[model samples]
Target: MQSSFSPLVAISPIDGRYQKQVNELSGYFSEFGLIRYRVRVEIEYFILLAEKGIFKMPAKIKPAQLRAIYEEMSEADAQQIKETEKTTNHDVKAVEYFIKDQLHQLGGDEVAEWVHFGLTSQDVNNTAIPLLWKEAVEESFMPYLLNLIATVKEMARTWKKIPMLAKTHGQPASPTTLGKEIMVFVERLQNQIDLFGYVPYAAKFGGATGNFNAHQVTFPKHDWVAFGNEFVNERLGLQRMQFTTQIEHYDNLAAHFDTLKRINTILIDFCRDIWTYVSMEYFKQKTKKGEVGSSAMPHKVNPIDFENAEGNLGVANALYEHLSAKLPISRLQRDLTDSTVLRNIGVPMAHSFIALKSIEKGLGKLLLNETKINADLENNWAVVAEAIQTILRRVKFPQPYEALKDLTRGQEGITQKSLHKFIDGLDVADKIKNELKAISPQNYTGVEFDY
Candidate 1:
């Protein structure tokens, strides 16, 4: 049955099922956003031309008038550009026409012909996309990622001394503090985010085939290359790729995607570890009123938030991998492949945002079960064999590790009493024996938990 809703719908889930979680990103990713960016590039280019006196624009265009034109670019103006695009069937040409129309209203029609002078569609698109990406990262992605890191840091500080039994290959091995485990992720994410910052948001402004052919033919005396560099790097605040095909190489963008993927992988690792901790009863979830963890299972309070984060991180990493791999490998000088792919740059980012929110939610729900942590550590007294053996080594005891291994290895349910009894029978001095008794699993978490 057809509902009352419109038949038109987005093919991607970013605009469909998960739309609400990512709707705020549309202002930087939608068709309207694309149009707005294009207009901005055209407007900036025109302003730069005037500032450089490349074209003898009308003297009536005062500084205030230029500011007004730039500031007055509203949603309505973006819509007008879209309307123009529909008629022209060429996105960049439509922008040129739109700017020319606006210039007519501003009584600057005498210089309208030079609006898109000596450039191709790639010039506008490359600059606009980088601008959008830069703004989105600074405004949306970075804040959330930094917040996540901060949340992890807080958890690290809070759980700094909470000793828990450590497992290796699913077997009790040693003891570690919960805070140190959380700090591992914090350190990993910080490193990857640092790498992400190093990746430049690069753009290409050379004409059709990177030669600036038309630009040189029109004014051979002018250094169009130098002007392109200044316009892109200085005015637009993007790294200008001096040499490229019709489209940018996208190597830097690929590096950005790879960096994001690494961070997501780290978060995925964190979610899995937290989920396992919850399952092991080391962490209990705060129950929400009216929230059903399961439909039929009354006693089930699932780790839904962490599960959600893991799923979204997986989705985001998949997209990031594809973007990083595909964006840098165009067919030749240019192809339409990157154009369509570029439009969905925000999809992976939206998933990343969604995952961040989920992780934050999961972190909020976590209630550390100190009793469980202590009980687990207390029960795993066999873990202290490492400490006892190491201390014995310090005192030059004969075959200290072998002695501890014989006493603890394959011995099920080795309690504190059993370990202490074995320590008392040792031929070590009273001081060494006392030290061994003090090395319980609860206090044996070496420097792993020290913040």
Candidate 2:
């Protein structure tokens, strides 16, 4: 808190070179952020207890005063909590004690003991983590993702009619529109992003061991399970995991991670394809004055942005995979592994944010080389063999596939003249020959898509 952080001295690139791009994530994923969320949960739980008549709130204790404890918590307050943690050696306990002190100062000392009543550290943690994660996704992550999707959508529509050769197994198989190729990723990404809505922002809120043992034993007439469900669902806007151990099952959280990993994987594929296009001169990147594309080669303009995006996306996916796999497992009732692992949730999110920004920038700099694309299609006249054979079959021609293969397969420089000659010599009528002659790589692309 007294200032030791500097970009030059930071260890991870997320906090160093790329910090400016993803700094907003600190509000939800930083150490101070974690403490603030914990304080929010503790204070909210206390207010809910008073509202339930679990304890009596004095007239002087206004709801605003209670909320202000967390809403207005400053760096100094978080630093104070860190100092307390240094002595207590328990982070959540530090937050609890900090709230108790706030309550005492507000002349509500009588109910200060109820600040974290009948709760274990996990009750505060499990709730706070999901609440912060939900906010981060909704407020921070989704906007960029939606904007990226929109940008891609607009690009797709812009290139909707542009035809390019389609490659399968690194060889030209047929022709597809550039827009449809881009839309493939767009559809895949949207499909996965939509799944986030179904994966609930889930939290575990029952007392220690998830039984609410202490709450029920103290108030035998009250249904503590119902209270937990309401507190987590109604109050926090998160789904409560009805059954869990000392920690939340994290199945929903893992689902979210898996979905995110898939989105990143799609983006990686997109980046690679775009990079290939740039290499093939299908895309010409815009150059800025005084910007060096390569130190050794002055004539080169590299696709560094797409390369950056691919690298960061790969890193993010690795972390997401680990998080999805590791978070759902713990030693019996609980383990400290998740505690440490969960703290790093923002690391992958930051990497992903950086990669998304890079991809957006890369896309902005792309200058579509329609000439190159059309030239590629024109050069690959052999690709139209598929269309010719398919049309011949429609006319009930004899062995149409084999005939077309003989003319195209293992043959170079199969120009339109040669194809026309082949069609003219066929045993079909002039109408059929004219129809076969009409087929060309440029016009042989499959049906147009409405999306």
Candidate 1: clashing pairs of residues:
none
Per residue, candidate 2 scores C-alpha lDDT tens digits across 150-219 of 9999999999999898889988779999999999999998899888788999999999999999998999
Judging by lDDT against the true structure, name the best candidate: 2
Per-residue lDDT, model 1, residue 343, is 86
Candidate 1: C-alpha lDDT = 0.86
Q: lDDT of each structure?
A: 0.86, 0.92
Q: Which stretch of 10 consecutive residues in model 1 shows the poorest summed lDDT? A: 1-10
Top candidate on TM-score is 2
The C-alpha stretches of model 1 lying farther than 4 A from their native spots are 1-11, 63-71, 448-451
The TM-score, computed over Cα atoms with residue i paired to residue i, of candidate 1 is 0.95
- Candidate 2 local Cα displacement, residue 413, angstroms: 0.5
